[model samples]
Target: MNDPTRAPQRVQVAIIGAGPGGSVAATTLAEAGHDVLLIEAGPHLPVDSAPHFRRDEMMQKYCNGGITPSFALSTSMAYLEGCCVGGGSEINRGLYQRTPDTVVETWRRDFHVDGITCETMVPHFEACEAVARVSPLRAPAPPSSLRLQEGANRLGWRCAEVPRLVTYDDKPSGKKQSMSATFLPRFLAAGGGLMPDTRVHRLRRIGGRWSISGTRRGRTLDIEADTIFVAGGAIRTPALLKRSGIRRHVGGSLRFHPMVKVVAQFPEEINLPGMPDPVHSVKEFEPRFSMGCSISAPPLLALTMAEHPDHMTEVDRHWRHMALYYVQSTGGIGSVHNVPGFRDPLVRVQFSRSDMAELAEGLKRLCECLFAAGAVTIYPGISGGVVLRTTGGVRGLPDTLRGNRATLSALHLFATCPMGERGDRCAVDSFGKVHGVDDLYLADASLLPSPTVVNPQGSVMAIAHRNALHFLERAAHGAAKPRSSDGRTLIARSNL
Candidate 1:
């Protein structure tokens, strides 16, 4: 960690959260010859030290033992996000998918967003893929993934391999192009300053400069910068803005793809920890929900089996013959609130009745697919759901599966600080400039206006890259507006 007391260090840019967005932003700015400071609330663990064990990875990378839950009037669903220097890009499955063309068009027309479109976003996506080394699997898909592809084909559904951010050289220990592995290293080589395990407590813009005060190892620290960019994930981003007294639409309409999964027991081995994700996705019912493979490791299997204690014995007996698959349904509105004096924000998920129905339908289809793929037994992680053996058994799925009975987890989270041209509650403008804050911007999933219905990592990186370019173009035009001016003043002065 950089010494916080080393003479009021100043920089041209100070970015909060060293995740994908912040990493990309820092890399670009530093490469452009600007002084940059990157700060992350979590410790910067070396890539070489990333544990091979799942439980150790959870403790090292996850925000809270990978157990952040969505608080709902009905039930709470676990949501996980990385809290390390590399942010989510460090801990997530490297599945990569571009923003669907239809989604981009929808934002352009309905959200009044400009400059970003299906046609315009392609180059940004390509650039990010080039840097991240996104590519297809090096070897044949594992039997588990093959089963998914086979099932989707048997059901006459559209299924395709999902690309991933990995550097595959036909080696066992393939390199995932996480922020730490790629951009963070480049940023450091470009003379960017990074301070980990530092929490920003307050942010104030005074005299045309941004001032940040925070804590590091129980010691007070402060920083001053010409501009600041907050790239904290959706939950923390809005919380930080709200804490800074920028309350307008700071945390509203949070969204996430709530997922439901099943463990399928087969006669053959389908649990290969070394095999990469098959990346096969069933898009027959996309935009609302989609189905894909899930981790089939023993630890996860044991955890899921524990959901229904009766199935534990069976799962343990046939652990090597079992695999997992999941369906991630499009999300509904949720909210993030900053609780005073608390680091963790209060999250409320408002998954509607219709959303739940969609998930139930998806689950049914998933079970049928598994049976078609020769699954001897299928576990839906539902309390009353019986061990399914055939397609006929899927029809009797409960009319409405209660949240408590369902084992749901979500990784793809969006919104909370959505971007739009001029909505009353829009947090940022289309280009990612926070609506009412000058010298401050957002460069993470929080800028997404709605659910993306796909693995959001690729699009998240592309969007951040595009917006960072926008910021660079503006900065190239002139010095940022004096820090004394409020967000409204800066907006009125610039044509951007």
Candidate 2:
């Protein structure tokens, strides 16, 4: 598999994006004895580098496709997305959550996603759990998670420990970067091929097959494959498809888990990341989209916390001590659409007025939790605020939160290439197949119809895994009678 000069090893299937969906799809197809080629648009950066999680790595991996993508009246903050071999799996914080039962029920009932239920989806979840090596945190920060627990416990709000998908070495100090280091190697090992630093500019359908024309090393590569799987995350997947002229609700209905991080500076050198003892995490804000605070200690990244004083003084004493806390918007869903006359497409994500208000409330609550957990000082992390010491400080937040892009960073961007029974508007069907196009499928977060209230990697992997199983089965049957399987006859169980 390491033979680089193998003369363009053609595979039965070509996949884009090396995140959980694409990687898992490759593995599933390969296991079923099909040839799968995994192509990524970026280099594979080593995760062993110090401050590897910093903004420097972010700039290298993200889509700088200019005109910082945002919703209506949003402040200008640079978004971050990993553009490496393993994609976001290499860059994500390794959290795993299945779509909640209620969430799945909503899709089945309200959203018209047929044949979907938590019970029906469980096997695929099990399969993904097996492949991705889902596990609990190696160490739990009771102190940190406890602060959140105390709040929920007092308020009688239910919370639980966050579940994750990660693999640990026995020396096993803590949760390891599971996706790139764990699952990707298996994909590479399973006779799957990888092409890095290659961009899939667009796709063209010629005759009966797909011709994906892109560039590499200043030369053009027009690849023809029997099957193509588009897993280019939420944004790029639809954008690429739309660019290739497969535009039928491909880029509309974009959803993002817009996050605002709050920083708390501790007394000692608590800002240091990756402790010696294997430490796990807590779910103080679980089942409702709030995460804990930590000091996985990146001095360079910790500097983003000019959160206090909102002035030069905090920047001068950058790394004294800092920990990060994040607030996710549960009340919002955004959109992405094509923009003419620009290299980068337009992504418009408008927070509901209620959503923005909830976001502000979450930040205030998180700040309170941090202080309760022993923060020497509490910085609201919003732009233009000196510091908010009391909960009352957040009441007048609309005035402070305006025009100061300091509180923005990207954690999860999802739901562009959505799947549903609603054709002509949704990108893919429940089986992960494209609506209008034949033999084209998308198996990533791109297929998610909306943002999951929690980390979406697990659900994405699970759903795609389930769908892949059925897709392969139907394909196998369809391939047996090639001329007859016009996709209309092989209806997905979800479709039925």
Candidate 3:
């Protein structure tokens, strides 16, 4: 799949990004006999050499060492995404879920997104799951996850095991179903071409074909393709489109699930590396908020504790008993923009006062649940929030949570290049095709018109699969044939 030795070549399709969306699209199109070039901005690390420590993973695969923050006026929330071949699928905790029916309904009714409903998207989701190996736990739930389940049951709130994209084999450490492990291999086997460590500097429409110029290994590279699939996530996709001068309603309407994290000290050792993330979630407060345990990797635990220097001694004393969890709630607008001469785009997220109040309530409820499950002490990961040792202290949390004292982050991001029937407002149409640009498509989380209110990997992959099928059908029927300015076929175009 990787041919760094090859100088330059033209292809029928150029997919910019090797994440789930790009991997799926490349595999599908290549299997259907299209000459596909899959480009990724980061170096490809072998799965066997992938690091286990969170800090090591961040330094290795994450963008900006996992410290990319929004340009907020006051407290900016850090947005975590990957810059490697597999993208977020490689670094994420493997929580795989279908987009909520309500979210799809809203997109259809409000945004006029066609052919994307719970019923219509199921087949695509199922197909994606089969390829990604989405499944339930093979071993028992981790102690931290069980504690969350116990607390939720005590409060009579709903909780369920989250299906993950992992290939379990009775061992504690299962192989993660990242794009590199799943679809990339299939794509490569199907004769798809991959060009890693390549960044697309500019994109131009040269007649009926798209011209792409970029740097690879400190050398210039170029390619011209009949079609371009920009699957470079929500943040980077809009930046690329804007840099390419296709700035019609792009980079607007961004949204994310802003999360507030906490470190809970229980009676037993709960910070187990074998199970880092919680397998369960308290979804009783659906659509608005949710509570789940984080992967209690020591590096992340240390990082969270570092925010509160006074509590470091206590944290270090009982690090084994500490478990990390978070309250993820919906929030308002966030945007991505391109700046000339800058490799990364500027990101800004605007959180409202009401959103802060709701997040405080969520943290309070989470503290109550943890105390019910026999937590001894809880240290809220906020700037000036005090440590709570009793249920009374947990009840008085609202007084301390003044929004300014909170240390928040955004884990899931979307809506930069939303799909809609409104030509003046949306970047892409319902079939994932860019408005006013023929054969240019977006198949990543950027295509989502709004928040899915859940982990979005399944939805992103399903949408990409569905859209790839759409492109396949169009190509089969000669509907996607490139034509000249005079409406004649561009038959002189040569194939690689």
Highest lDDT: give the candidate number.
3
Model 3 lDDT per residue over 305-346, tens place: 866788787666787798888998877688888777889999
Q: Backbone clashes in each candidate structure, one number apiece?
A: 3, 8, 2
Error of 1 at 165 (Å): 0.6
Q: After superposition, how far is residue 221 of candidate 2 from its true place, in Å?
A: 0.6
Runs in model 2 deviating more than 4 A are 1-10, 45-51, 59-71, 75-78, 140-159, 175-177, 267-269, 276-289, 294-303, 307-321, 337-343, 391-396, 399-406, 479-496
Alpha-carbon runs more than 4 Å astray in model 1: 170-173, 479-496
Can you tell me which runs of candidate 3 are displaced by over 4 Å?
Answer: 1-6, 170-172, 275-277, 399-403, 482-496
What local lDDT does model 3 show for residue 225?
A: 78
Please list the C-alpha lDDT of all candidates, in the order they appear: 0.80, 0.64, 0.82
Candidates sorted by lDDT, best first: 3, 1, 2
lDDT of 2 by residue, 1-496 (tens): 2432223434467888877788788778767766666777877666543244655656765566212546556643335566776677766666667888877876676556768998999888887777667666566543444555554555554556665555565646544544566666776666666777668888888888777877765567666677889988887898899888887877777766666776656665454345432122334554345755443344433444555434435534644455556666555556666678765666665555555666676676666655555666666557666465555554555522434434665557777777888865577887788886887999898887777777778888887787778778887788421232232211111000
Q: Look at candidate 2 and tell me the lDDT of residue 47.
A: 52
**Which residue pairs overlap in candidate 2's backbone?**
61-83, 71-349, 139-279, 139-280, 140-280, 173-278, 273-296, 273-297
Give the Å error, residue 434, model 2: 0.6
Could you tell which candidate, 2 or 3, scores higher by TM-score?
3
Query: By TM-score, how accurate is candidate 2?
Result: 0.85
Q: What is the lDDT of candidate 2?
A: 0.64
Q: For residue 248, give model 2's deviation from the true position in Å.
A: 0.9
